[model samples]
Target: MVVRTEWRLRQQSPRFKPQRRQAVSLTSRWIIGLLTAVYLLWLLVRTVGQPDWLTQLPALVSELLRLVEIGWLATLLVLWGLVWWHERQEAGQRLPPLKLEELYNLHPADFERYVARLFRQKGYKAAVRGRSGDLGVDLVLTRQGGKRAIVQCKRYRNTIGPDIVRELYGTLIHEGVSHAFLVTTADISESARAWAQGKPMTLIDGPTLVAIARSLQLSPPSSPKAS
Candidate 1:
């Protein structure tokens, strides 16, 4: 199954990587704009109050205008640089599907991302929902024929138990998905494997995950550039 999407891969800049905060950038811009306006107003009022107001108005206004231009230009440049830095950092951190040992080293959120990418590479439309309050579903996978499956990723050394498998089954029913996938970095207990048998569920352990990663001919999904 070769799942297809509109994303294309781009080379990442290796210089720097930073976490992005869109709100902070927007707030900074607003602050600069407000300060610029107040400064210009103050300059105008000070010029008007001078004894030879008319004589000095031209020079004062010209200087004020130039100052505003320079301030705005510098602010814009700094904002652009911040945006570029964050984007580059994100791009640089996109790792290819590698060894299971390497997968074990990833943050839990990053592990979810890795699993989503893995499924996408295997021809499934996968979306990551590994956030707080996301229910038990981590990644939702849709097949070409419109069949849907929900995935739960566990990236830890703890053995997967029947309870977890059973919980995913309940989630599968609730979500109305056709199947459930429980991917874990550790081994699945015998009871857990037995519980999943004859059910619409698949358990992927560390070895199996590593095997899949090794077999893949990766064409990673594109990360949209910040506007």
Candidate 2:
């Protein structure tokens, strides 16, 4: 039975290719636009014709306006739902499905480890600090016969503000590190970015993190990493 089904599917493969839907004719579009304009004009004329009705209909108009507001809100909700659904569909198409345990295992610490490994693979001697203490940094990376860099990793769900950047900058100065990097899976706020600008400190946000991961060929986390 399986063999027969396989044979049938193979035979039908060419017939099953999707075809593009035809575009609406220009005549149809013109008719739709004309009808919509006429209906709107008629409504305007009808509303103008009844002055007494209009005077009495303020309450009704208010109620209709409320209903229109509700309709607009519902339309916005539906559009947002559609956008979310499309994003989910695209994500599924672009990546392989992950298991729950695999997702659960993806932690900020794991990301730190991955980054360290990547740096090491690139011939930079790197280490992940288990705790944020007097070490004055999170990841210490040393380039061969080059400057030693200190990286501060901020895994936040929301935007990393200027406060964290300021702290790292202070630490960088205190430690006398040649270079400093503040990395996060989330974005840094405009103020935070501006604050770090021209300060001899590097700020790596979501896009930069993703780019680095791609460059290093690091696997995607099963679950979303904290920003």
By lDDT, who's the top model here? 1
How well does each candidate superpose onto the true structure, as a TM-score?
0.55, 0.47
- State the lDDT of candidate 1 residue by residue for 1-227, as single tens digits: 12222111111212111212433544565775676676666667756764565455788786886787678667766866775575445334444445665666555665776776667556566666666887889888877567888999998798899999999999999999888999988999999999999998999998888777656645444432221
lDDT (0 to 1) per candidate: 0.69, 0.59
lDDT of 2 by residue, 107-218 (tens): 5455565455445544555656647465447788776565687887766658889988888888888987777888776778999989989987989876776566455445
Off by over 4 Å in 2: 1-105, 218-227
Superposed model 1: Cα runs more than 4 Å off? 1-95, 218-227
Best by TM-score: 1
Candidate 1: worst-modelled 10 consecutive residues by lDDT: 6-15
Q: Model 2: clashing residue pairs?
A: 156-227, 186-227
Instruction: Tell me the deviation in Å of residue 7 in model 2.
Output: 43
